[model samples]
Target: MASVLWFRRDLRINDNPLLSEFRQDIVLPVFIFDTQILNKLSKDDKRVSFIFYSVMKLKNDLKAIGLDLAIFYGEPLEVFEKISSICHIDEILACGDNDFYAKSRDEKISQSYKLISFNDAFLLPASYGLKKDGTPYRVFTPFYKSVLPFVEILSQNQYKIKSAKLVDFDYKSIQLESFGFEKADISHIPYIDKPMELLNDFKPYFDMYKDLRDDISKKPYTSGLGIHLRFGTIGIRECIRELILYQKEGIDTSEFIRELIWREFWNMLLIHFPKSEFDNFYAVDIKWENDKDKFHSWCEGKTGVPIIDAAMRELNATGFMHNRLRMIVSSFLTKDLLIDWRWGERYFAMKLLDYEASSNIGSWQWASSTGADGVPYFRVFNPYLQTKKFDKDGVYIKRWVSEYKDIPSGKLYDENYLLMYGDSFYKKPIVVHKVASERFVRAYKDGMIK
Candidate 1:
């Protein structure tokens, strides 16, 4: 039977269920640059360039194995239909995607062809962990505990690719520009081609991760694996294996693994509650100020709060923000600026090279106190205090906000001082932290009452 190996998020050849489990007589490996999604993205989107690079690398790797990856530029349905017209396709195998657009697209394609999907993107399927009554767990800790046992079982790699004849097809090479995206400068980004290298680089710092993971100033702070994991350049099982290996070496990896489980929790939450992408999960009726100028300032990293400015500038420049910085900036946007979390979430979607819909949406909701197991509305992060805590030496701030280099680090932590200094070099604080925090909490309480 002729089967098409449709590559989506899972871009790698190693540890891929789609490649290892296939037993068809004839197989066509394919990757599509979905124009439907691409059209909505900016021409200079860093993710497009990264994906293009990864896809090309995958193509070459497949060719080395006496197989070729066919590249297509169109919607999945139309592309599949085109492939179906040429050959008698028995089935198309791909890694399952739980995002709304992916689900809808796959459903449409399944109507016309036999489409089979595997859970290669994540360690476990979204439906794995549930409460006693069969309802999905809303809280994370219980969910993490429930799924923790299965890590061993899931980690066990057991698969071999059966010999299959490569389907002969006229494949075409496509450039990043052909898809209407400018070639992005991805050299500064880590592990675009080699995920294992990044993993190796992260090992030395893994010991300090428990204590310093939240410190934005610590270079190589968190495992720089988010982008690799997001695109399936590295498999979740492979990462789990590394963690387990560390655990066997008597290195405490539980805290790091917990963060991975949090990623899982967010994915599961998104699968069950897709509407939370746009609406509040808990239905808090927050009447967001959504000041256009304030949001623009926040996006441009001109929030007058040193930490917020630094983090925002980092994200805008590099398509990456530290986890702690994400939390701080998100709080500043949602609570401090009284802007809609959706606004900030959407902006991240546009910029972050590691942007995963589930994680991004889940995190934004959490920051805004509109999600299950989210931070309380009363717990607004004081940007100044956060700076004093995470970036005490002002290393991160100085690195990103170059204008603040000559200024004393202490002044950055003082909102009144920055405000008094005025708009000479940097922007003044758009909203006072004390006043904004109280107003936000009051608004949230009012939302609950209504």
Candidate 2:
């Protein structure tokens, strides 16, 4: 009998629980570029290209053994329909994903096939985070505390690191280009470089991640392993294992470890409250001040506030922004522009290289003061003030918004638009931040009272 190893988000070979225990005679490993997902990605999505490249990396790593990865491009159920029709299969083992699309797809797959899934996406197992009450934890810190012991236990003997062996598989007929996606050129974007380096060997920065993490300009200093986590290029368990090893060596990697815990918090949130994928967690009687024209301006990074514009433009151009900038820009959208969190969420969904539904929705809802277990509604962040604090020199802003020449001239705080090679084309801030803050605050306070 053959056990099919269905690859969804977990794309790597290290520390995968589902693959580790599959002691079957014939094991078939298959990856599907499910159209349910691919159809939604843009034609030139670098994230898709990254995933394809990572999949190829996995296949090459497996090819070191005498096996080839079977890849398919179609609706997942359809892909399975064809696969099960031709290949003799007994049971399907996979590392289940916490995202909406992945869960729905897995449910459909399970209905049609014999499926047993495991949690390889987190340091703490997803099941361990629940209370005696049988509900998932909404607050992050308590959840973190609850799951700490499981993380400790799993850290020991996680991956026994056997030879890079693939459980022999026959590939199915498939072509990625047949679907509407392009090969990665990876030309101008420097962020896409050296992913394996960032994954396997980067350790120094994670030790300092606590102090250096929030700095917008020092972002590349933080090991840039987020895309790795998002795509599962480096297994979550591997990251935690390394973190524990660092701790044993008397290094304080708690901050980096906390970020991983946060990652688990997000996925757990998605699992317990799937409805949060599109809807707000708490009631906000106040209506969103959603202005399309303003949102468009914001999208173009012309919102007139330099930092917000810079952050938005950075995201639009490169599909990434510093985590601090992510919060600042999101706050500007939901609070200052009075746009719905959903609007900003969809925009990030389109643009971010590391976009995950749980984090995106959780962050946006937190900014909008409509999510449980996040920033209080009254705590609105001011982008101009935040820029002055985190990016005092405005170096990050200048990188994306070249028109802010005054900052380069060392007179930006004086407040007149410094000519971008001599023209004032940089957009103006859309609404007065203070005015918007008061509006959002009063409305939210009133909503809470009501």
Candidate 3:
């Protein structure tokens, strides 16, 4: 009896524990184009295109090794049923996904088949990172400290993949058009076949990450490993290994490693409190003044706040946004516009090519001050101050917001100067910063009293 290697988020074969375990067996690799998730996405969704590209790449890699990847487009359960009918599958091996939907899906799958799943995406498993009292951590610092030792030990446990015996099966891939998604233009998307090359390229910048990461106007000072990490193209263990090597070179890798810990921290929170994905983690009443018009403006990058607009436009165009800009734009939506963080989170889920549920939701909540260890509710990011600090030269703003290309750097921070450009050329600021800041604080305070 042969085992089926079910690939979900963990797409790559390198450092994949699930794939490594079934190397000696007649393993048939499989990926289900989950329609339940796909139905919600746009036809030109870059994320869907990226996933399709990754799946295709995985298929070719497996084909070269005399194995075949069975690609199916349907509900995962139905797809598994079809797979069972085609092959005499004894067991299904897959990496455990920590999100609520994934957990529910995996539970149903386990009921039907001999499912052997491992938490291959995160450095430390969800269960291993809890407090001494066995309660889940609400804050990041303690959580990071608690998991550090385990992370160091497990970071060394990298998976070695041996050749698998190819099973005789008619393997086929469902066309992108079959699922109502257009054929992906992989030109703009950074889909790396060998993640190691990307990691190596990022090494030189790792030391400067802490200093220049927040500088939005500059070229990417941080590692652009998010998309690769999201799909498990590169395993977390391998990333940690790279960090270890960097540390040995006397590089201050603490800042970069902290980011990886943050990713794991969010994953742990999702595993422990699944409701945090949709609802506020802490029980607090919120009166969301969700203005549809303002929300649309924010989405289209027409809010007239150069930094906010730039970030939004970048996300709309590339399906990716810088980390600092993500916080800025998110804060603008939730705090400045007084919109619900869920609104921003939903939009990110729709657009971000590197969208991971836990990270997206967690980060949105952090910016909106609704999550555990979130920024204080009173602390709203002033777009003018942020622009002056991060994009002092308006280079980032000029790149995304075309109308602001020739605007003076000093004038970019002036609301009145930006307004002079007019609604015809550049949009006027939707809300006065001073007024909105006061209104948001008052509203939050009133909600707390009620």
lDDT of 1 by residue, 217-305 (tens): 86747877889889989888888888888788887778888899998899999888889877899978988998999999999988788
Off by over 4 Å in 1: none
Q: TM-score for all predictions?
A: 0.97, 0.90, 0.95
Cα lDDT of model 3 by residue, 212-301, tens digit: 899877678877788888988877888888888878988778888899999988988888988998898877667989999999999999
Q: State the lDDT at 402 in candidate 2.
A: 79
On TM-score, the candidate that comes out on top is: 1
State in Å the error of residue 198, model 2. Answer: 2.3
- In model 2, the Cα lDDT at residue 82 comes to 76
Provide the clashing-pair count of each candidate structure.
0, 4, 0
Clashing residue pairs in candidate 1 (N, C-alpha, C atoms within 3 angstroms): none
What lDDT does each candidate get?
A: 0.87, 0.73, 0.83
